[model samples]
Target: MKVFKVVCICTIYVLMIMGTRPTVSLFAHELGASINHIGLITSLFSIIPLLFAIPLGKKIDHLNSKITLLLGGYLGVLGIVLPGFFPNFLGLYLSQLIAGSAQTVLILSAQDYIGRISTKKNRNQYVSWFSFGVAVGTLAGPLFSGIIADLFSFQITFLILAGIGFISCIIIHLVPNEYPIKSKKSPIPTSKTKSTFVDLLKIPSLRLALLFSALILFAKDIYLTFFPLLGLQFGYSNSTIGLLLAINGIASVIIRFYLAPITNRFGTFNVFIGSMIISCVAYIALPFFPQIVIACIIAFILGIGLGIGQPLSISLTIDNAINGRVAEALGIRLTVNRLTQVITPAIFGILANLIGLIYIFLVSSTVIALGTGIAGHNKNNRKTDVMEDSRVKSI
Candidate 1:
């Protein structure tokens, strides 16, 4: 049953991602949108989620997750189908906004469900598996969309994705609800009650985790938003860009499955540090070799680094959450990540227009390196906590 649930959730996620991006710029072009308009559409997708994450998180705490999941999936289907029918810039932006909201709900509900089902001994492994599912979906979405676009039309692609989302909704509806863990009494507030976000801000480990998540996502946004445009600038066709993006997806899937167990063995902190360093190297080297083939290789390497780092960071964040606040904690992490996605691409797009794509990669690499340093500081703090715990137990 758990296996079936995970499969259903993964399928839903894939459909959502497939419908949300990949052909967005092409869609914008078809609608006669300017570059600024294209950037706004993309940024709104991330920004909507950032704004809604906390409120949705609080709602998830008290709502039935199964219902929430079903509603989110249906909303995703609506979001996908509406734009296909309209086929205009306004429709495109509206679809993304709706999709972003659905994404927030689906993700928070799924994380809450996972937190309820897994034990500490195997939680990390299960988290890795969940992340792997997302990786697989993300990997498949672009290729699937690209093929559909080539074989038929972009509108048809959206319709097909919407149909898939509907299927996922049915699948999720069929799966039995796993009841959330109940508390006998109210849990500690962590601190002042007036400011929940501020309460989260007070936890040093959570703060570091949020920062790491934001930086990693910023790097990802740089690649996702600009890479296609960069390919165009270099005279590559849409089909070629699609293939290159597919390569990135394949790299992500392979690394997530292959490196996850090794990360578990070496410690997630070490994996996080090492992956960030490799990602930094990949970004720095990206522009130096501007050949299409070389860029493809670098993109694959970047995907590998991303695949390893993301799941570990998520696991660490959830593990460090104050008791009874898993949804809130994951919400905060998602919020920070979405915020970065909102800000970074817009800034990078402007910089790309002003300077060049090379500088975009350079700036991203420097940011990731700085994040790695922060993550190391977090590692030291964790070690100190363990020592303190041990000393108290000894007494």
Candidate 2:
């Protein structure tokens, strides 16, 4: 129940952040920003997180997470309000960096809070719940922002988002301050072979989970970044573009409610691997459908395809982490996720200028499909181990 409460409060916080996510891209486009400029602004969102996620995770592990939560909340409000006050392209850039950095802390603390409260027995259920809440927030954010941005203006929409973020900050009080589920003491270091990040990289299961999750995120980034531009080219309104984005989120929420059953029937590896394959198809399909309805359909398929990997990644990360530092594992996981967030847009942005916008979706699909192959190999290995262990038990 405490996990539910934390997730509910976080859902509201995430709703504000997700709502604001598209506004930055759309607003910059409105201000005559080129694709490269937009990519720079978007990359700024993850730049700080890529740099600071590990240190921030360490901070959350040692300190009261509520303090971190509060800081993230207030900063979310400040970040939202900044662009409104300045009302320029430059303002949008500054707002994203500030907001993205704040969100990094906010999300990490919320996730760390979840790990602190969850038991191994019920960890998967709670992780799914957290992911479900993220889906809900993601669904609500773009639809609501789209309506407001269209009805009023981007500046007014941002100001309203600021007010909502502040209220979420207030809602943080609802979460109970519980103790860490894992030991808070740091592991004693050994001189013989210092465990480095490379050691973590050596884990086949972790490598599988991290790559699968990050590629899903990368595909979603492409959707969020370029889909609006694609829609606008067809003369769709801001509200329409928002709905297209929301369709993706809506599909994600729908799939997650049934994800447990889905995983049981298909196997976790199959679900993740299958999701990527579907996503690859959907991304390649997006460029051809200029019609809003068609685009929405593609978006829904895209959502369902890409959405499964996230919660599954969380579950797998917990199952696979060698150190039992779920907090640190999550931090490292996030660092990988943010790295994709930072890199893909930058590469695609430059490619858009060099080649064309349509080609980026092809590139996105290729990357996603590549991840599926690697995961498929891991999945086969996992099954073999399970079967062998069962044989040993029978003996």
Candidate 3:
């Protein structure tokens, strides 16, 4: 129940952040940002996370999550409100950097919080709840921001979202200073922290999980960065674009409610491969359909494909982590995730400029399908090697 409460409160905080996303991209476009400029601006949002995620995670391992949660919450409000006052490219850049830093703490802390509180038996359920809440926030964020931006202005949208973020900051105090399920293992020594990164990377399963996470986030970054531009090219209004984005969220939410049963029945790895295949097809299909209804259907399919990977990845990281160092392991996951977020848009932005935007979907989908195949083949090969080693020992 406490996990649910934390998830709910944190969901509000996430709503503020997700709400700002589309507003920032579309606003930058409106401000005459070239596709390259939009990509650069979007990349700025992850710079702090890419740089600081592991260090932040190491710090969080020793501290109460409440402190970091509050810190991130207040910082997020400041970042959201900054552009409201300045209303320019300079303002957007600064807002993203600060917001990125806030997200680095918020996300790591939230994941660590739920992880520490739940036993292995219910960890999946807790993560599902957290992911489910996040889906809600994301769905609501675009819908509300789109309408407000349409009816009012981007600046007005910023101020209102900031107000909502500020309220969530107050609500965070309701979360207890500590959870009942604290780890019994001693903390890692300060000297070993450096080696922890190396040690964690040595795990084959964790390494695979990290790769999957990076791939998933990379595809997501492509969607978030390019979809609005695609919608505008189709001559859709801001409200229409927002509705389309919301449809993606709707599909994600729908899939997550069934996530536990589905993963249990079919297995996470198989589900992951299936989802990527679905996502790859969705991306390839997306470019051809400009009709609103068909586009909405593609977006929904895309959402379901993307949605399942995140929670499964989170569960995998948590299950694989060394007992005392779960937060650090998650930090590594975020570091990998943020790396893709930082690189994908900038690279694709250049590509979009050179080859045209529609073809980007095809290009990206190919990469996704290829990466999935390579990773799957390697996993199977590893299993075969282990089986052969066992056979030799038995002989």
Candidate 4:
């Protein structure tokens, strides 16, 4: 049953993200939007989710997981289908807002479910599978959308994607309920007493994790936002751009599937550090190469870095959460990531207009290198703490 739920959620994610890149810019262009307007459209999705993540996560903690999952799928279906009918800038913005809300609910619920079902001994392995599912969907989305857009039209492709979302809804409905361990004897907290975003911010490891996640996500945002534009600048077509992005996804999926075993052997911190270093190299090399084949190769390496880094960071964050606060911790991490997604692209877009797209990759690489340094510092501090604790016990 747990596997079934995971599969269903992954399918929904693939359909949604697959259509996002293809439809968003095309929808904006169809509505006669400028590059600034396109930026607004993209930013809305992340901004809405950033604002609502904590509240929605708190809500999930008190609700039935099954219902939350079902509602999320339905919301996704509604969000996807509406844009097909409206097909204007306003419609595009509204769709993004709704889709963002749906993503918040689905992600929080799914993470909470996975956290509850798995034990500490196997938690990292389960989470890796979850991440792999996400990677698979993300990889498949653009490829499928590109094929549909080429063979038919963007509108029809969106409609088909919406249909896939509805199927995911049905799958969620059929999934067996796997509720968290709630005490039936205790009263649920009221809104004022419920866990607030401020409450979650007090944990030091979570705080560091959120900061690191944001930086990493900001770098990724720059890549996703400008890669297509870079492709165009180098005389690549829409289909070729889609294929390159697909390569990125494929690399991510391949790496994530095997990430758990590697982390198990080397430790999470080691894998995190190594992956970030590799990613830094990939981003630095990206702008120096302009050929389509070389760019794809660089993207593949970047994807591997991303795949390893994200799940390792998430596992570390979850491990560091206060007891029974895993959902809240995940929510905070996602909030920070979404916030970066919103802010980084807007800032980079302006920079792109002024300095050119090449600088975006170079600047992003520098930011990631800084994050890697922070992660390394944190790892050292952790080792020092452990050593001091052991010495005190020996005495």
**Top of the candidates by lDDT:** 3
Residue range 1-395, candidate 2, lDDT tens digits:
78877788778877888887788888988898998778878888888889888767656776676788788888888988988899997788788889988988888888878777777898888989999999888988889999999999999998888887888787787666755454433344335664445545556777788888788889888888877777777788889888988899999999998899999999887788788888999988899888778888998999998778889998887667653366566677888889999998788888888888888889889988877777677778888999999999999
lDDT of 3 at 332: 93
Residue-pair clash count for candidate 2: 0
Scored by CA lDDT, what does every candidate get?
Answer: 0.75, 0.82, 0.87, 0.74
Please tell me which model should have the higher TM-score, number 2 or number 3.
Answer: 3
User: What TM-score does each of the candidates earn?
Assistant: 0.90, 0.92, 0.96, 0.90
Per-residue lDDT tens digits of candidate 3, residues 269-368?
Answer: 8999999998999999998999999999999999999899988899899888877678888999999988898898888998999999999999999999
How many residue pairs clash in all the candidates, one count each?
A: 0, 0, 0, 1
Off by over 4 Å in 1: 183-195, 288-292, 378-395
lDDT of 4 by residue, 108-185 (tens): 788778877888998887788887777777777777776777787767777788887777777777767876556222
